[model samples]
Target chain A: MALDGRIEQAVVAALALSKGADAPPRLQAALDHAVFPGGARIRPTILLSVATACGDDRPGLADASAAALELIHCASLVHDDLPCFDDADTRRGKASVHRAFGEPLAVLAGDSLIVLAFEVLAQAAGDHPRRAVDLMRILAQRTGMPGGICAGQGWESEAVIDLAAYHRAKTGALFIAATQMGAVAAGQDAEPWEELGARIGSAFQVADDLKDALLTPEEMGKPAGQDAAHQRPSAVAEMGVAGAVSHLKDILGGAIASIPSCPGEAKLAAMVRAYAEKMTPVHLSPVRG
Target chain B: MALDGRIEQAVVAALALSKGADAPPRLQAALDHAVFPGGARIRPTILLSVATACGDDRPGLADASAAALELIHCASLVHDDLPCFDDADTRRGKASVHRAFGEPLAVLAGDSLIVLAFEVLAQAAGDHPRRAVDLMRILAQRTGMPGGICAGQGWESEAVIDLAAYHRAKTGALFIAATQMGAVAAGQDAEPWEELGARIGSAFQVADDLKDALLTPEEMGKPAGQDAAHQRPSAVAEMGVAGAVSHLKDILGGAIASIPSCPGEAKLAAMVRAYAEKMTPVHLSPVRG
Candidate 1:
């Protein structure tokens, strides 16, 4: 199936899970806000891709992992937009949660998403408690402290930061989780898949940094130049725009090459290569102009 | 084993699971902030108590459940103190997360706790995948949208509010979750336990409102009148302190009476009675002065 099909299936599953005879209207609204006109759904796409590479018998698990990842992403976005963090007024070309529903609800919404992510994963992986536990650990690690996205957010408050650590967490962590989770869902070995994910995630983050340097706010939805404005270190800051572009290419190349020889390797490899190629020079070109 | 002993064991187990090999310094600090001098580990206690009541040999599950519940509570507190929500400067008589660490680290720490809660629960209940799923679902519902704590936060934003709904969410939801989760951990049917927990949680919220109305800032360890200041509807506002006190007794009575006949019935029943009596007006006179 195409990435869009897989994402739609994941979104549908997520929406279906949110339903209950006792579900409150506010909760329904919050769930809707979480998934409607969703962001890239890149995590799920990667997860599905890896799962497909492994085998096709695990579509349900793939969808569940995708939904869980999106829930985490949505939670982070809700928290990130709070006044304490980015204070973003808009997301996905619309008012951010704090802006739309107010701060209190926004916080709650984020909290709910975090809880729901685990719920979805647990329910979806009922027979695979070990995998679920492992997946939960991976997701939690990426979401929180020291080497997680939350830590990445913390780096912004400091006087100085290690850019590599920041990139790895702020972007790479979830992507790493996606592939690892996907591989686990498919009953494949997790470590090699995690490495592939890390590379892809790192490349993706760099591409994002390049876009932030080169794109207009209209193109990217949120404000551009935030990295430079905040003096948040980035590949673009360290390597310059052209150098960053070249680096993204190298990272993407490595990511594509890392996909192991397997039964569905051709399709999976093609998807990775296509995604990276399209993400790198082509996306960067528009932003630079 | 005694409740305190169980708590210690659970904490040790949870801490051992922390990432970063030696347990990251920041996470260690957070664990202390979360566990030690912790506000009642009532949820986990109830879970163990319920499990004991159910004749389950697995007190380990309950202990882990308690630790996980505490983590969730800690996570919520960290988020609650952010610049956007209560914006409180202190928690548990000490500096709130944002005040102690920077806002960013505080956010990350909170997120970590939320993630850790799920991870612990997943591992703790590894032997019972169905129970783990149930626990996750129950936790998600209590913490997630509409009726969950998150939805409760969202309700604060609207121009109009339902006072009962607000109280149910802000305080009661987690309490309900705790009882239900404890019941599940004990491998018992959830209905009776849920009823007991709901009543207790409702009464607990009323008590919290009473605390807000009656306690001095020194006694409460936080600003006492902020709810009224924010014009947020509270039990004290709707019922008056004395009326709220009466309601607490009624709710506690209901909760105690709802406990199923079981091995631990006498002890659990006694504890509930004592807690309710202590909270009631007749018994509260001594503490009032």
Candidate 2:
């Protein structure tokens, strides 16, 4: 199966585990809505690609880790769009979870998905107990406080912000989880993958900054220029649009170069290059200028 | 050290793990505020007591599990008090996290704590990998969907409710985790302890129903009659105050009887009897009448 297909299947199966006869239909529907028709599926793709690069010895564990990462990403998006936060109306060209299904269910759905991520990892532990523990640690570290996505969100409330730390926790953490967890799932050392993950995560954040700065809501499929409106520290805000774009290029280059020495190093590098091309803004073409 | 003291230390240390120079001060404060001065500390107490009854072989893992359970409980309370949910202004006789730090911080705090729970377990895995996996599974099952606390919260949104399933998910799930995780942490078979946990959990819920229906907000240190106001399914609503009180007694009796044959079985029974006495409403006293 294709990477996206596997990820989708794993996600569906994970969510299905929660579907009881007595479960609130609305919460289940909201969860389905949050997951299906995902954004880029970039995190899971990176995860699986890395796992495959490292032999992909445990396909089931890899898929579960990838799905869990994606679920956490989706859940963060749902919560971020809540009225208290970004209050975003549209996500992936549709109404945000809260807009579509009241705030309470949105909160519940997000919470459920977070728990589901751990549950998926735990259930997959039957085959590889140690790897399961490692996956859980990687996911949890990247999702929680200090240097995780939660800290990334918490940084917004602070008076001063460190752009690198903020971006890392907000965006880089999950990417790190992807690469590290992918490696771990494939029975490889996780440390070697961290640099590559960090680079990709940094590049992704810069690309996001660029899109937020330059795109319209219709073009982005979500609210644009939100960073400025929210007074959130952004790469574009810290380094001007052109500078941010240059930084993105530099980071992607570093990402491609940072691929660890693995059985599938060449393929991993190619994957990074492909992501770099995809993330590069089309309007930045010299001919357009 | 005593169980409560150990739990307090573990909780303090767990929250401390999230504290960094860059962490949002408000978020750190809110996380601390949510956990400290905790109400009852009943879950962890039960967990530790069960672990003790089962030999307390791995004290660190047991403490971590106990702390993780309490953190999950604390996170649930923070989310439950959100404006979109209960919108309660007070918890444990003080302002709720959302009320004190705003909704965004409250949400972030809750998310961070949830991740912290698993992170604590993962960190403790070095000493006992298999037990850590078991702890993660137990915690996830009790906290997430299908049968976890998330499912418990989701029950509120349903058109029709199954009181048994709802109470089990909402209340019984954590108690089950407490017993099962305790046993797992102590290297004992967790299944034997499930009945005891279930009975204790059911008893606690019934007692809560009685308190909510019969007590005032001041007396409860939090909003009373919330279940009735929210139209949530409650034992008192289903069985009435007197019947619920009777049910509480029955559950307590079953809890005492359900003690597994552990070395500390007598001590565990004594603990249950003490809780039963504590849960019995004061007004029910013949002298008071």
Top-scoring candidate (lDDT): 2
* All models, RMSD in angstroms: 3.1, 2.0
Tens-digit lDDT string for candidate 2 (B117-181): 99999888885787899899889889987888888888787788777788888899999999999
**Model 1: how far is A244 from its true place, Å?**
2.3
lDDT of 1 by residue, A4-103 (tens): 7777777677667656543445655766775678877888888888888888466677788888888888888888887777888888999888787777
Runs of candidate 2 with Cα error greater than 4 angstroms are: A223-233, A237-241, A286-289, B284-289
Clashes of 1: 2
Per-residue lDDT value at B40 in model 2: 82
Q: List the residue pairs that clash in candidate 1.
A: A105-B154, A108-B150
lDDT of 2 at A256: 84
Fnat values, one per model, are: 0.45, 0.73
Give candidate 1 regions above 4 Å deviation.
Answer: A19-31, A126-131, A283-289, B19-36, B215-218, B222-243, B281-289
Question: Which DockQ values do the candidates obtain, in the order shown?
Answer: 0.45, 0.76
